[model samples]
Target: MKDYVIGLYEKAMPNTLTWREKLECARFFKYDFLEMSIDETDEKLKRLDMTKEERKALVDLMFEVGVPIRTMCLSGHRKFPLGSEDKTTRERSLKIMEKAIDLACDLGIRIIQLAGYDVYYENGNEKTREFFLENLKKSVDLASKKGIILAFETMETNFMNTVGKAMEYVKKIDSPYLGVYPDCGNITNASKSLGEDVIFDLKKGHGKIFALHLKETVRGKFREIPFGTGHVDFNEIIKTSYEMGVRRFVTEFWYTGEGDYKEGIKFSKDFIDRKFEEALKDK
Candidate 1:
């Protein structure tokens, strides 16, 4: 297996940090890149509204800091799910996705990690699933035209909670731009929710698993916490995924603004490095 380049998620930086601070943290942590996010907030949504010049300036700053934004996590689905029943809301969701895709192209982002929610904070049914797939097809088409990859992240939801399920869509879409971004922590949570041992079929994706969101999750409680404090079997995940040809990982967690974040960064990076090697050497 090839070596992996680990990235810090956008939430790794506290909201108080300026762009410079965030980039500095990435550089200081010696990360290969940083993951940008477009979630359900006026502040985060501003990235979609930035002028082309402004976007260029931000990208330039990242280049100066040597911390490229390689991927985008479009978490705005929690607010505007594609499977929303309301026609207006579903249309808005698609618009947000289109705008995010445009911004991603401007920023040189290679992948857009989409949330797995067909409908968030709302009931889902056959019609909702149909709407979700319909909107996703549109997004995939636009992404293909723009030369961008849209990988669906395994979520803490009843829909698309595993890589296997995501593969169903990948096959249906039949586009290289569409794939899976499985989160190990979310898998653990989903397993607990189902009262069964649900493990990710990393190899089943046939290397279409574009990225992995590495995080810790205490089942039935939280998905983001300190490393090794959850049920996630990092050893198994890394070993299985690496053998399946996964060579990219994103350490997803929110900055707590507690002690120096450098400690957390160092911990995360080193842990990933060590576990990656450990998994490779196992058996």
Candidate 2:
């Protein structure tokens, strides 16, 4: 039996494809599951409003295709962040959080990866941080009520660029529903900027880590970097995270629309598979 589950981020495939097509592609790529993306865009945001029938259809499609959407990258808060200084935006953020939790419950998604940011595209201050923490507690309460896991994604911003920083908020909330699903690439970049050890930072979260985003990044770049062309040491990161009790992983990359994305997907899956195989060898 496999020691772990590996999933592909939905954005790793072209957005032009339907959910069925995406799940088919994920299965063809030999991925265990698909990590759905609910980014800040209106098109993605509207998915939260999907009807019960549509949700059931998608779930049925999963069983038929054999590739379930087990996780969600809920980055919608990057636009309507809970820590926004504006009252209307904060209210919208809470509403979005509620809708996202409800959607996760309907979709049978176990974990929702939250963007670790108090405020994006706006100046952050103590007030924003306070508002963010306040709303975050409420959000966790909602997730707890539904028994859905809400985990933070280690972002590229200094506010929460490392697993340790994410854990600070996780500890503050102190809810089983609120944990960390860190991005390895972002933490790698954060290590470079903060002069800290990536593995050590990861260990800080320890039992609080639910999953990991195995993305590639350079010293300054955090997105769309070709695997093996960046500085991230997948071998060590996966090994450390595995030892930390993380059993789920998702390859986080974007389609650049330059070459065959299928090739990219296959390559990423193979690369991560090798890493997991190496990391878990004889463990």
* Backbone atom clashes (below 3 Å) for every candidate: 0, 0
What are the lDDT scores of the predictions, listed in order? 0.85, 0.93
Error of 2 at 220 (Å): 0.6
Candidate 2 has a TM-score of 0.99
Which parts of model 2 are misplaced by more than 4 Å?
A: none
Best by TM-score: 2
Tell me the alpha-carbon RMSD of every candidate. 2.0, 0.8
Per residue, candidate 1 scores C-alpha lDDT tens digits across 1-283 of 3467888997877777888888888888888889998899988987798997898899899889999999999998888999999999999999998998899899999999999888988999999999999999999999988999999898877688777788888898898899998888887787777775554455667669888899888866555588877788888887777777778889998778788777777887888777877888754
- Model 2 lDDT, residue 236, Cα: 92
Cα deviation of 57, candidate 2, in Å: 0.6
In model 2, which range of ten residues has the least summed lDDT? Answer: 273-282
Clashing residue pairs in candidate 1 (N, C-alpha, C atoms within 3 angstroms): none
